[model samples]
Target: MLARVKLEKGCKSRGIKLSGALAAAGLIAAHSTKDLSDHQREKYAVVTLIDCRSILDPVLSSDYMGFYHSAILNTHDVSGGENLWDLAKRCYTAYSNAKNNNKHFTDMGDLNFLMCKAIENPGLTPSSSLRTAFISVFEDPVTDDTNEMHGEVGVEDYVGCSSVHGVGPSVAIFDTIRDGRLDCACVYPSPLHSRDQMQKLIDDMKKILVDGCANGESES
Candidate 1:
């Protein structure tokens, strides 16, 4: 709880949202993949799924959930031995700048055009082996208004609040907050990667977030 508060404060100081901070942490933790062979590490990319409903239309309220979201792709040279905080700030800055420029909306047409081309040329689609790393950060809907629906809920109960499954990424992280506490689930294709390895990566990501919150470092 204390760590959460501190992290939130740090994010506010830097004009970063909690989702952006978590995304940064996920990417930083993903740097550990450098332990793998160079060929394997070269294929690793970070894809952040961000909610765009708020920015889509100013008049539309948060309740208007029309599937307004987009994915931000960020590739890192983890071999450079970059600082975690620095990398995090860069990730957040890129996302912020892109959104501020209204690229999210403008890119929709480009995405459609690319999809059409991919449909014509299926060869353009990446194979399963080329899957990138993915992280999705979201807030659970267990608010005061809907508290009655989740009677007798606890931290552990939040585990069932989210579900993630797909072939697009080798590793996918689903993150959410319930009752002011953060919860995350890391999933990977079983035969492709060992559960123990993925679990360790997830643990490292959590530790990074907690440490960032506890340290109360000023924005760099």
Candidate 2:
């Protein structure tokens, strides 16, 4: 339902700063398909869901019983050697453009119509599986999770996420910043992507983030 990420020692390139969701989304999509080599570029669509609670006309509270989120979809060409910062900037810019134009509010009806059409006729979606985007992230999380709160609640290691079993992206990222660390819950369809595959992808993404922080830029 929501996502959050941590940025350390922000790096600005072309005056565009990188955020956690954009950077992670681009990198995941770029490295998604192993079939493409570093020389080849592939197009990947990312759907970012923004919580509309505060932005809604009526202004809903966090305790609102229903889903009050909107999605903004964007596509980018990615390569195996894609720079995380550059790709993140592109993603951010696209989202900003869409958000600035009120696409989230304007495009909701269109998206719903398309979703209904897809549901009525699976052939409208890729592989007739209802997969709309390659990846999905949250624009901003409503709350920040903390380890102290978890301890008081007697909660141990856990992953809070939304299931993408019906109609959604191939991978859904539920990211949260906890105790200054980024914790992500990745949900992918079963049998389509193996545990090993997702594990490798997660490892690669973490390495990119770590390296970016260490070197103050993305290595790949």
Please report the candidate that would top lDDT against the real structure: 2
Candidate 1 residue pairs that clash: none
Q: List candidate 2 segments past 4 Å from native.
A: 1-6, 11-29, 62-65, 217-220
TM-score of each: 0.70, 0.82
- Candidate 2 on 23-118: residue-level lDDT in tens? 554465446557766877777788888888888788888768777789888877777766656666677788878989999989999988887888
Q: What is the C-alpha RMSD of each candidate to the true structure, in Å?
A: 4.6, 4.1
Q: Model 1 over residues 1-220: C-alpha lDDT tens digits?
A: 5666777777777776666676667766776656754334332355566566655546566667566567655555543344556666766777667767766667768755764665566456565332434554442222223434567464224343333343345565665555565555666766667888778777877888777765556533
- Pick the TM-score winner: 2
Score candidate 1 by TM-score against the native.
Answer: 0.70
Q: How far is candidate 2 from the true structure (C-alpha RMSD, Å)?
A: 4.1
Report the error of model 2 at residue 139, Å: 0.7
Kindly report which residue pairs in candidate 2 clash with one another: none
